[model samples]
Every structure is written in structure tokens, then in C-alpha cells.
Target: MEPLELVPGRYIGEGQPCFVIAEIGQNHQGDMELAKTLRQAKECGADCVKLQMSSLPHKFNKQALSRPYNSEHAWGETYGDHKKHLEFSRDQLHELQEYATQHDIPLTASAMDIPSLYVLHELNVPFIKVGSGDIHNLPLLRTAAACSKPLVVSTGMSDIAWVSQVYEELTIQDPPTPLVFLQCTSAYPSPPEQTHLRVLDTYAQMFPHAHIGYSGHELGIHVTIAAVARGARVVERHLTLNRTWKGSDHSCSLEPHDLRELIKAIRSVEAALGSPLKAFQPSEEACFMKLGKTLVAARPIRAGQMLEEDDLVAKVAEPRGIPAQRLGSLVGGYLNRDVEQDESIMEADVL
Candidate 1:
């Protein structure tokens, strides 16, 4: 698959460096000052910082919104109020976008509903996110596709057949919208057993045109880093200033130090992944000289004697001689000169 031009010059695909997203979803605690976490995300090596956008009234039914939200992480008595507290105003989102621009990092958001989607389109975000909650919303997916921006969709709380249907519908358009399918499990702090990173391979196989990625809600950086090793071209992890903060996601989100370490480890892994070809590497030359074995005389053989397999042995010699692997070619050949027992055998000594 061709690399996706996620932004003008930046891309995500095979052979490209993994694009890391710092998902700062509601960990901001609704404070504008806290939202500056975007700067921290940039400093920690995130390619993009993302927030979740939702027009509460459109995103939830009245009954769902009015439900009691009294958990310890709740900021309000009702679910609606809790969401509203975390939802930034349109103007505030614009300000945050500008702030991200000034900091030289791309800012994007997940559109939780049609209204929020339109708001994000107007904000001209580089890409739009479709969280798992909206994956089953075909109408919204169609609308998002028609908007002509890259859509990063998380496949959580849905089965493969449904994901395949969504992939077909969105990609079959006249000019297929650029798409990235992220394998995700909706559970907060998803267990390693449920992470199912192999889904990345399935997506890569099933949706060859779309870029494959992983959106992790799992604790620590290990699973997410393993996702990159598993061929994920893009990776998203929730970010927080403090995991102890009063929010449901805070418990699963990575703090600044962890985020930095994650990015650093990912880079190191990418470098180590290197090329697939097998050949003698320059880095191994010194070690080879010191420890590599070569063919040596198993017993003294006089000049003009026919050599046999039993006449040669492999040993570490002071001066490099015929490689041990060339032992077969020396068999049945006549020796040009006498050799001492265990003497290094050279190509020129054979006829």
C-alpha cells in the first residue's frame, strides 16, 4: 500500500515511521489552562494531539443524558453535565487549534456526532477521528466520508464483519476517502489478553488500501510499542498529565514521562527493525575477524597429495584462510604444498 499523506509531507504506511497520536480526550478536566497539554504532547514527540468533540444534545438522548453520573470521577450529578464540563466551546476549540499550530503540531478531534463533525470540518482540522462509539453510525460515517478529509476510525465494540462492511462502504466512494482503521478494544485499561493486536494484521490483509493502526487503551507502553512492532503504521494512546486525576480515562492514560519513553522506545524499535535482507553487515566485521573459524589441516599432508574431507578441520586461525563453508570445494583436490597439522589452509595451496 502507498504511504498516506496524512499531512502535506508527513505520511503513515509501510516503510514510513509510525505516526504517534497523543489522545488528550477529556483529561484536560475542562480547564482551558489544562488544555495546553497539547504543548506537552508535542514536546513528548507526538505527531498529533487529539481531543474528543461532541454536541451533547445531539450525541445523547435526553434519557441517557439525564442519568445519574455520580461516580468518583464525575464532575456533575448527571451524565449530560459531566460531558458538558469536558466539552470545549467551539471558540475554545478554535483557540486550541491555533495554539497547536503555533506550537508546530497538528491538532485533531473525534467527532462524537454530526454537529460536532461539522464543527470540526469548519475548524479545518488536518484529519477527523471517528471514535468507536460512532463506528456503527453509518449515516455519520457517510457524511464524514463526503467531507473529503482523512478519517481515522477506531474499530472497538464491533465485530470484523461489521468492520468489513464499514470499510467497503467508505472506500467504495467515487474518490475513496483516505482511511486509517485502528484496531481498538473499548475497555478502559484493556487487559493484555483482550488487546488483540493481531487485528492489525487482519486489517492490513482485508483493507489493503487503507492504512492499518492501533488505538490502545491498555495500561503502560509495552502493548502499544508491541503494536508498532506488529506493523502498525499509526498508534494512538490517551495522554494525561497525571494518571491519578479525577477522570475515568486518567487511569489508563499515559503521563508525560511515560509518553516520552513510549516515543523513544518506538523510535529505537523502528531503527532496530531495519531491513529484511540478510547479508554480512559492516558492524559484524570486527567480531568476525576475532572469532570466525576457517578451514585448517586436520593432519600433515605432503605436496601433491589428494585432499579429502578428513584432511580439513575448522578452527580460528591468526590469518584468515579459506572459509569453513568452502570445505566441500577443497575435497578431492590435490595440495600444492606440504601442510602442518592444524595449519590454516589457503585457496592458493590447492590445485
Candidate 2:
């Protein structure tokens, strides 16, 4: 089963570089001036930038909307007010999309409701993301699958049964859409114990045709890299300009320096995961020349004398000589010439 390749020519699979997403979900806080932050993501070496798009009324009921919300991160008295303030207008989204396109960064978004999903379709985004909160919303998933764009869905607060059901729903469509499943731990600043990164393997097993990814809410960048090492083809992490910003995800988000370092380390890790076949490498040549042990004579031996194991010792020879691994075969061979003690033993010396 070949892994799915997303738009912009980014491959996510065993032999491909890990695709990275910089999630800018509501971090702009209703300030379109911060849209330029997408450039920062590209400079930090992210393959894509993601934002959250939703309609407040479409996503929340009356009771949920009117509920009081008081926290250092809250922007309004009620949850709905805060959400509406954070929602981007259609024109705003268009402007951001244009900006992202001009900069050559693939901009994607997670739609919380059917309306937002259609809006993203109208925008013609390279891909659409279904966040964890909407994983159980089969109707939305059905609609998203119908959008015909590549889909990247996150499974966080849902179980395997629910995921399987979603998979069945999506596959039932004619000419099934390409899909990528991201293993996510939904908590803000999720604890390491609850990360459950190994679920990436389970997703690969259950949906062998789809690419598997990780959406990390953990505090540092290492867990995301670890996910890459564990066969996660894509990695998504929240990004913010400043951790002190007043937003629910700010603390867990990677700031500029953190993001730069994370990307560097991720690329390094990918390079280090080289081929599985164990053999000699060009990089090992210098070390081999300096430290590779070779068979050497432990005592002087006259010509025509049969060599013995006790007469040889393995040492770092000045010039390349018979490898110590072939010492067993040399034990009964006759020396062709006299050799001094501690001298390197060459294959030509044996008969």
C-alpha cells in the first residue's frame, strides 16, 4: 500500500521526508494584520500552514453558546462571543489564502461545520482537515469526503470503533478520496503519559491505504520528531509568535525559535534513519582505516613455519592487512617469509 501524497508535491511515507504542518488555529485572535505570520511558517521550514474556520451558530447550540467563560485566555464574556470574534469573514479568508498562495506556502484549514467546509471548498484549498472535535460528526465527515479534495483527519477524543465507522463511511463513496489519519491527543499541553503516540501504528494497520500522521499538543518538539521516527509520515504542531499570547493553545505552541529548531532536528532525524540493510558505508571509511583491528604476529616466525592462533594478536595495523575475522583460516597456513613480532600479517604471507 503506497502512502498518499498531499498537494504541493510533499510525500508522506516510509522513504519520504516527513511532511510538517504549522497550525495557526485562532492564534491571530481576529487580527488579520497577523496573516503575514504564514511567511514565518514557511521560513521555519514547514510544508503547510493550517488555520481553523467555523461558523459559531453552526458549531454550537444555544446553551453551549450562552455559557459563561472566564479565563486568562478568554476574549469575551460568553463562549459564542469569543468564537464569533475569532471567526474570519469570507473576504478575510480569501485575502489570507491569496497571501499564502503568493508566498508559495500551501494553506489548509479545519472546518468545524458544514458551512465552513463548503467555504473552504469555495477557496479551493489544497487539502481539508477535520479536527478531533468533529471526528464523531459523521454528517460533516460525509460532506467533507464529498468535497473531493485530499482529507487529513485527526483522531483524538474518539475510539477505534468510531474511527473504523468513519473509515467505512468515507470508503463507501465512489472513487474514494485520498485520506490521511493523524493520531492526536486533544488536551492543551497534553501530558507525555497521555500522548499515546503508538496509535500511529494502529492507524497504519487499520487503514493501510491511507497515510498516518501525528498532531501533537505536547509541550516540546521532541515528541513530534519521535512520532516521525515511529513511522508517522506527517506531523502537525500548533505554532504561535509568542507563548505568552492570550490563547488556549499558545502555551503549547511552538514559537519562532522552537519551530526553527524543531524543523532542523526533524530533517536531521530523517537523514539519520537511512537504509535498513546493514553493510559498509563510505562515512565509515576513515574510522575503519584508523581503528579497524587486523591480525598481527605475536612472536617472530621463520619462513615455512605453520602459523598458530597463539602466535597472532589483533591490533590496529599501520597499513591495511588480513582482517581479524579470517584468523581461524590462517591458523594452519604456512608463513611464506620471516615476520617480526607485532608485525601486521598480510594474506600474501600465508600459503
Candidate 3:
């Protein structure tokens, strides 16, 4: 598939560097100052920093919003209040976007509802995110596709049938929306058993035109790095200053140090992934000279004697000779000259 230009000069797809998104989400806890600090994701090597945007009234029904939310992490007594507390004002989001620019990184947000989707469009974010909760909302999906910006959609709390339907709806347009499908499991701090990273392969197979990625809520960077190694062209992980902070996402979010390590490990893995072709590498030349084995004469034989398998052995011969693998071909061939016991076998030594 051709690369999707996510931001100016930044692409996501085959041969491009994995696009890493540090999702700040609601971990800012409604603190504007903390939000700015979280934007430092660029310093930690993220290609983009993302937040979650929602207009509570447009996003949730009254009954759902009114439900009491009294968990230890609650910022308010009701679910609505808690979400409102974390929701950044439109003006605040604009400020953060400008801040991200000064830091030289792209800033984006997941539109939790249609209203917020339009808001992000107005902000001209390089791309728009569709969090898993909105994946089943076909109207929002259509609206996001209509916006024509790159869309990064998380597939969580969803089945393949629904995901396939959504993929069709979004891509049926004339030009087809520039899209990325991220395999995700909604569980916070998702257990390894449920992570189902192989879903990345499924998405790639199911939607060859769309870029495939992984959005991880697991405890460490290992799974995230593994996702990259598994051919994920994009990866998203939540970011937090402290995992012990009073928020649900905080528990699963990567700290600054952890984010740095994750990026470092990802680049290393990408480098190691290299080309698929297998051949002798220049880096191994020294080791090959030091320890590579060759076929050697196991016993002395006079000229005109037929070579025998029993007469050949592999060893680190003083002078590199016909490779050990050629020993089989040498069998039954008459020797052109006398050879000393244990001498390396050369092509010229056989007729």
C-alpha cells in the first residue's frame, strides 16, 4: 500500500518509520499546566501527541452521564462531572495545539462525538482519531471521512464484521479516506493473553489498502515494540507523568522515561528488522574469517583416488577452501593431486 501522508512530509505505511503517538488522553486531569508538560512527548520521540475530545452532551445520554461515578479515581461525583473536569475547553485545546507547534510536533485528538469531530476539523489537526468507543457510530465515521483528513481508528470492543463494515463505509468514497486501522483491546492495562497482537495481521489481510497499526494499553513497552516488529506501521500508547496518578488511563500510560525507552527500542527494532533478504552480511566478515568452517581432508589420499564422504570433515581450515556444504558434490570425484591428511579441500584439488 502507498504511504499515507499523515503530517507534512511525514508518512505512515510500508518503508516509513513507525508513527508513534503518545496519547495524553484525560491523564492531564484537567490541569492546563500538566497538559503542556504532556506535550513534551516530542522530546520522548513521539511523532505526534494526541488527546481525547468530547462534547459531553453530544457524546452521552443523560442517563449514562447521570450515573454516579464514585471510584477512587473520580474527579467528581457523577460520570458527567468527571468527564467535564477532564475535558479541555476549545480555547485550551487551541492553545495546546499552538504549544505543540512550538515544540515541533504534530498534535491531534480523538473525536469522541460528532461535535468534537467538527471542532478538530476546524482546528485543522493533521489527522483525526476515532477512539474505539466511536467505532460503531457510523454517522461519526461518515462525518470524519467527509472531513478528508487522515483518520486513525482504533478497533476495540468490536468484532471483525462490524470493523469490516466500517472500513467499507469509510473507504467507499471516490478518493477513499486516508485511513489507519489500529488493533486494540479496550481493557486498561490489558493482560498479555488478551492483547491479541495477531489482529494486526488480520487487519492487514482484511484491508490491504489501509495502513495497519496497534494501539496498546498493556503495562510495558515490550508489547508495543513487539507490535512494531510484527509489521505495525503506526503505534499508539497512552502517556502519563506518573502511573500512580488518580485516573484510569494513568495506570496503563507510559511515563516519560518509559516513553523514551520505548522509542529507543522501536528505532533499534526497526533497524534490526531491515531487509527480508538473507545473505552473507558484511558485518559478519570478521567472524566468518575467525570461525567459519571449510571441508578438509580427513585422511591422506594419492592422486587419481575417488573422493569419499568419509575422507572429508568440516573444520576452521587455515586457508578457506571449498565450503563445507560442497563436500557432498566432491564425493565420487577423483582427486587431481595428492592431499595431506587434514588438508583443506579446494576446487582445484579435484578434477
The top-ranked prediction according to lDDT is 1
For residue 318, model 1's alpha carbon misses the true position, in angstroms, by 1.5
Q: Candidate 1, residues 169-255: lDDT per residue as tens digits?
A: 998976678999999999998999999998888998899778999999989999999999999999999999889989999999999
Superposed on all Cα atoms, model 3 deviates from the true structure by an RMSD in Å of 1.6
lDDT score, candidate 1, position 186? 97
For candidate 3, list the clashing residue pairs, or say none.
Answer: none
With candidate 3 superimposed using the best TM-score fit, by how many Å does residue 345's alpha carbon deviate from the native?
Answer: 2.7
Per-residue accuracy of model 2 over 1-351 as CA lDDT, tens digit each: 565668667766668888989999989888888756988999999999999998888999999989998977788899888888888987898899889888889888999999999999998988899999999999999899998888999999999998988888887766677888999989999999999888988987888667899999999998998998888888899889988989999999999789999999999998988889998999999998889999998999889998889999999987778988888988888888999998998878887
| Local accuracy by lDDT, each model | 0.92, 0.88, 0.92
Q: 2 or 3: which has the higher lDDT?
A: 3
Q: Residue 328 in candidate 2 has what lDDT?
A: 96
Residue 310, model 2: lDDT of: 95
lDDT comparing candidate 1 with the true structure: 0.92
- For model 2 the local lDDT of residue 3 reads 54
Model 2 bad stretches (over 4 Å): 173-175
Lowest lDDT 10-residue stretch of candidate 3: 36-45
Task: Sort by TM-score, best first.
Answer: 1, 3, 2
